[model samples]
Target: MNIKKTSVLLTIILISINAFCQQEVSLSSKLKSDKIKAVNRSISLFGDKEDAVEMNAEDESGIGIIEDVEFEKGLIEIELLGENNPGKSFIGIAFNIQNDETYEAIYFRPFNFVAKEQIRKEHMVQYIYHPEFTWRKLRKEKTGEFENEIKMPPNPDDWFKAIIHVEETTVKVFVNDLSEPVLIVDRLTKPLSKKIGIWTGFGSSGRFRNLILKE
Candidate 1:
């Protein structure tokens, strides 16, 4: 092949490889892909769901502790903590928000860099206290489908920061500030929609300190 042609082919090959090996994101920064949407841009403060809370519980328990949280503009924050309360494993919190509809999924982004091995399982299911979202006996997922897991930080109890970026089909998570999200569950390629408050998973009863959904 001519030198110019050869150079062009090499460039194409490099780009293709980079695109595959390259990650969707490296941190809690902007999303370059068309699928990613920056929904949690703003945060609005509102009333509280004034309710004493505890740890996760058995399924069929109707919102053991419901907090009346409120918000306004954009980003919504759901704060949950065991807070010095040891032996608090299996506790879960349901984030009910008011906004445009969006997909249902969860993930954790440890340092925002998701190792290849992490994408095999569903992180949202395991990390999220709510297993009913797709539990067969619980009968939650209507489609009877499954997707890849969105990895969480190394340790769930560890004091690491994470962000759940919700768009259409894809949910991107960032760990420790914006480091290529520990994992990107689904790369949404569909239209936009609104997502109400996050549902409290079944068999989980945890305390939610702060919950808000911006309008």
Candidate 2:
């Protein structure tokens, strides 16, 4: 082949490879402004794209649901970073989300993981059914059923991976470690398949990237 022809072929191949690697949906494009307060910012996790959805909510109820995606039974893997501070920072995913007001969520209170008090550690991971079954209600009614402490905790300030597996009535959450789930809920509040979203609690700011939904 001629030198020019060879160079052209190489460029084409590189472009194709780059396009394939960046095919994963970006969070910024999936979420709407009214659903959750967010802004586009550069994320190191996604090499092909420079923008990731940064959830900036003054209230804990802010949620960014992915548009046009129906999540029934599958796995959701994403990278999340909670605000690093002494106060509680709720950062996680909500699946089976019917709307902003309704969904089941698995969130992490990073500050609690390394708290001086043992009670705080117990509330490290939480599973809540919005508008009905909250962490407080569940803890009071069903102890040790909805929330639990992480066996292996990650840094609050650093980015960590959260893997969520949902099938019918069962939902399991794995943080950092894929082998064992940190928290499991056998009886899901909303059993049917619904939209998925990235959630942030009141007074919380989070960064999300590489949102992949597999069914």
Candidate 3:
């Protein structure tokens, strides 16, 4: 091929590669008020392993939605710390959030992380689609399908990593550096919105850091 044609071909190849490769987006940069939309939660920015955000709520659920992120199918990973407050510590990531009332989430029950009872152990991690399928509903009807027992649970009082891989039809959650996913479930709701968030359950306070999205 001629030099001009070869140059154009090379440029096209580069653009195609960039489009399909994973692009890491740092969510810590959107700490400003104009960028985050909080629902029934109070958020504060601080420094830990890196720049982090802490969320607290006394009643109802709390979620701090990153306003500009429009994630459909991608990977969301973050370091989260929750106390062993038995039934109070629900810390995890929320995505495809249409609003405060509706969304899909995969949260951890840190209180159940190292439970002695078999039932509690099974409830360590959960996936829920609000306004329809909640933890209570899924547990009652579907039984042990939506939630899973973490074979290697993390410490409740310390920082642990939660990596969630969201896909068109399914979601997989890996705790810490585990090669195998602790929880895997089919996607319940369709693509509602592009919003993604950090969530904490009632009476729970969570510290989050190293929030990243690969798309």
Residue-by-residue lDDT tens digits, candidate 1, 22-67: 2222111111122222132221212243322233344432232112
The models' CA-based lDDT, in order, is 0.34, 0.73, 0.86
Candidate 2, residue 98: how far the Cα is off, in Å: 1.5
Ranked candidates (lDDT, high to low): 3, 2, 1
C-alpha root-mean-square deviation, candidate 2: 8.4
Model 2 — which ten-residue stretch has the worst lDDT?
37-46
Clashing pairs in 2: 59-202, 60-201, 60-202
In what order do the candidates fall by TM-score, top score first? 3, 2, 1
Runs off by more than 4 Å, candidate 1:
1-56, 61-76, 82-103, 107-155, 158-161, 187-195, 211-215
Cα RMSD to the true fold for all candidates = 13.2, 8.4, 4.0
Tens digits of per-residue lDDT, candidate 2, 1-215, equal: 99999999999998887565432656665543333323221112232464466766574467766666667777888888885575548888887776567788888888876776777778888888987888779989998888888877888888888888887888888987759998888855646656777787877767788877766
Q: Estimate each model's TM-score.
A: 0.38, 0.77, 0.87
lDDT of 3 by residue, 1-215 (tens): 99999999999998887576554445456765457788998787766556787887678878889887778887888899998989789998889998888999999999998799998999999999986998999999999999999998998999999999999999999989899999999999788688898998878888888877767
